[model samples]
Target: MTTSPPLIISVSGIRGIVGASFTDDTVRRFAHAFATELPMNARILLARDTRPSGENFAAVAIKALAEAGCHVFDLGVCATPAAKLMVLELQAHAALILTASHNPADWNGMKLVRADGIFLDAAAGRRVESAYHRSKRRTGDGRVESVARDDVESRLLRRILDVVDVDAIRAAHLRVAVDPCNGTGALFLPRLFEALAVSAHFIHDTPDGQFAHEPEPIAENLVDLSRAVTEAGCQVGFATDPDADRVALVGETGQPLGEDLTLALAVQVVTERRKGPVVTTLSTSQVVTDAATANGCPVILTPVGEVHVVDAMVAEGAVIGGEGNGGVILTDVDPGRDAAVGIALILESLARNGRPLTELAAALPQYSIEKRKVSCSEQDLQRALDGLVQRYPEALRHPVQDGVKLYMEGTFQCPWIHLRPSNTEPVVRIIAECEQRQDAVELCAVAEGLLRGE
Candidate 1:
């Protein structure tokens, strides 16, 4: 007997470990299911990251999609955001991106983007999921063509340049270091740097999927990037995940800035130029709220997911929006989160203010946010959440969307904890933030104790 590897299917799309639960058969099934949702002879964009499995998966996806009666235009080995942009630029019916974004090297899966160039919302995702399970596959006559789509990359870079003060960045003569973790960012960053005339030092610049370190780009995984910034005497350092859809930062002092700050800084920049609503997730730090508040921009809180943020952004006419996990969404450039956009915004922030990243970060409102995960069965997790809700009856509960977020004393700047299940893994996430680090740590401990029935 063999156990099946877990496959994560949600509004985020289907993802699983390659050669495990995610096989050629899995791709064909989802491809066929997605094809059924579109019209006959629909135009579809296909792209992938630099994952070693991407090539084979793309081949399978192209053939599967083509056979299912959708025209497949393959943009081989491109970033995830670029694929989303191409979906809109070409006015395609939809897109299939063959990359398990931010997942491990052995992981490869597909992200299905709707005609609007955004991930399908929960309703749309459910429709696809229902089709996938029915074992009904659609077959139609279509063609597969390999496309360069250099215009996608050019347009992405061009939009970044257009949104920022290009002359200011050039005059600053900024020196920066980057670690793409040997993924698709390696292919885009050089062009961006050349266009900006900024000096750059790159590590793991290869487009191969061999990650030099753990690929999440969080502080713990960015030791090399931190050291590179300090040793190279660069003004800042950046690290992007495998697909380059997200990015994290290191300041001038060789210290890794938390992922939340990436959105905070981006918010600061965008809200300064345009005043509108800012959308983000509940798990995001209050620092982002503070940044937007300082700029007199209203903030909208959504459930914890990129699609949630993007949906709220579009509905609210948001000037900027993203999740706290280093994903920044600027509608002017693209509806999806783009690291290239985040990079340019932060650089422009530094250049416009004529200050170092460390100083700029230090000037932000202070808060301590801690994120932790614990292995939990669904039954136990639900019981723990119920227990916590009862245990803290006085805590003001925000509307339960994806999870439960309880604000201590129903205050914004006070301590708070959010308990939610992981979308991609088999665990429950405990995110707590407070003015003091120890308070946040204690909050997480409390959540963990309840989760364990302690």
Candidate 2:
């Protein structure tokens, strides 16, 4: 999964090895394809993460968009969510963020965002893909514009501040530790903390793209971050990928709280003050269900990916929705998954509750989540799913949606196994969550058995 040099195109976006699959030609062609759909004189927002190959790819994209007769607004070294907010705040026609997110340092990609601060939906994604193959460039020229970096950070931070209580957070005098993975998050997190007047001890705070560790912010990769939380005497620790869209947390006890808690904790903050439905994907943790239900809010489960979660929130009028991978989509601020907003919500939750983050996290119903993956072709994954359905006839099968989601609700206590092919990679992801750790692990074993033709 580390820079395999295989180009992957999905609803998630386009990702590949920097020089191999994701080349100058790839960026130019994709940008041209995206530009073909835009009207002349359209103001386009362009941003990139701190990846080594990001600037080169961004130049290719800027050239393509400019050649297409669109006004290009370049906000250098900006997080994915910040760029998304810039699109809506500046009223840009569209936006392109050059980031592979948690992908390896050698890998790079582009996330095409709409003007409303959300990623492209299925229909729009197809249009961009079709344009890439068509390779048609609109005949004309436009100029590139530059935005002040301070201005860029302020706009997104203001949106999050508007939705959260700054006075409450400042009064808590909470000290927090943050690990931005030396990505664009460093450009955003510090400023937001300063605005909230929260005490933050920041590590890996440079944006040079030299990641201090594995960039995913998972528990295994966050041991250093976990240690820093207790070492710094902070209430909580936060980690973000290069783009800062997804955020994982570490508790005051020097424990990795897992990425799922990011959304669950944010839901605790948002729903306590405001009332609205909660939205998330099938891969999200069961803790979210417990939190939402306890608050008298219904949960809408969508397919994997933040775009689907955002779409469901828009349709259902949900206040907050995001993927389980440390993404919190606050619809009130921007539809994108913003770690900046996640930070605000977490601080506000601690401030309002007058409790440590450890207690706040423990207050949520505990659940065990086991995540595993199998490297196989898509057809092979489907074959395994079919075999699984044949073996477990009692399970409810959902075939037409994202993947094979087998629900075991009536007999089991909210236990489910969702076996879905990875849209961004050539593999099948097996996610199982339940009230017990053994039950979650057993569910994964069931999928593994099916994959092994047991």
Candidate 3:
């Protein structure tokens, strides 16, 4: 029998195609590593999304943690952020979320959180990976047993409600449309909307492990959401990925508001209420930077990933943070990405501004960004990056991070370009930001030319 490589292990967690990179043995190894890294007798929180294989992976993870002598609290079929919140609410030493986020239904993975509810950074992830690789198997007595599920769910929901002004949201009386993509968000979002007294139109809200569309909430995949929002005359439409860690919005006019706007709007909401530092990944749109600056706040840029952004947030004591892909991180609630929190924050912004969702979104600065990926082997990646750097030496600003990011000055059209290799795929992703779409597209073409040795 052929065995797959353990679901792409790294600083954050393991994620890969089900029955391929992720299997029971792989889950056990990684969980054991996590257990070893955490303190002995540590109480760990475990939760899974509504994937067909989630329960199997969760079972393996629980048993591994238990065998490592850790107490486990299992919350079945919960959003990724909910697991993080439970870690902080329950005062557990760590939390493990079994989800693949926006990946296909056939994929499953895990995200790790510390006791403080922050995702593990690159260095910490490496440590866990090393431990996973080195750990020796110990016999029985180290397995997870069931705990109280209802109590945990109730407490988690209450914690979420306490952070937002439920009455204020109700007063707005905004009609909202939500598509959970048939993931774990379906488990809690309806109850949350009811508590806020908002009228919600739901699609793909069942936890059936059957995705109504592509699991990603990107613009191309949100056509139904856009139509539903306009047809229902909803104030706004929100869609979450499989794990519910990220969210995408559709404007009232059935127009898909880019994912970057989600973060931009959330930043506007949070910074308006409480002025503080904001953090976002480098690939994020400048709208977030503009929003933060307008509110007398500075935007901190990190490498592309939730953990990197959260780490910067913690260091800067940021009030709110998020990524370009619609993942909002509210530090006051939990440093991890939370789609539910994002919905409440956006509604709060609307209520406070006394404006419609479209109007609020229209007020932000506009810019164009184009993203493209090219498949390349490891050798070709190194060669292409070297060539690009050599061709545009004057434009280089930083190169020590995940990939090379260039800042265009002088008469150059685009403002910036970020080129990074994918962690999960054999592709190099190039993102260009400019004042015009044509310029951004042209820059991507230039990047492709360089990669192809043209």
TM-score of each: 0.98, 0.96, 0.93
Winning model by lDDT: 1
Whole-model alpha-carbon lDDT for candidate 2? 0.86
The segments of candidate 3 whose C-alpha lies over 4 angstroms from its true place after superposition are 1-6, 139-165, 410-414
List model 1 lDDT by residue over 1-454, tens digit each.
9654499897777889889889998888888899999998999999989999888888888998899899988899999898898888889999999888888787888899999989988898888888888856787899987767577788788777878889988888999999999999999988998888889999999999998988888999999999999999999999999889899999999999989999999999989989999999899999999999999999889888788889889899999999899999997888888998899989899999999998999999888999998987888898988988998898988884766899987676557899999876657899999999999999899899999989
- Report clash pairs, candidate 3: 11-125, 67-142
Q: Give the residue spans of candidate 1 off by over 4 A.
A: 1-5
lDDT of 3 by residue, 1-454 (tens): 9544345665546788788777787789888888877777788889888888988888788878888888888887777887787787778899888887787787788888888888787888888888877874443344354546556557666766776667788888888899998987888788878888889999988897899998989999998898889889998899999888888998888888888998999998777768889998878888889999999998788888888888889899998898898999886776688898888888787767778777888899888999988976667777777877777778846544877777776332337887888655436889989989998898788888877767
The root-mean-square deviation over C-alpha atoms between each candidate and the true structure, in angstroms, is 1.4, 1.8, 2.6
Which lDDT tens digits does candidate 2 get at residues 59-143? 9899989999989999988888888888888988899889899988888898998878888988999999998988877867789
Q: After superposition, how far is residue 436 of candidate 1 from its true place, in Å?
A: 1.1
Ranking by lDDT: 1, 2, 3
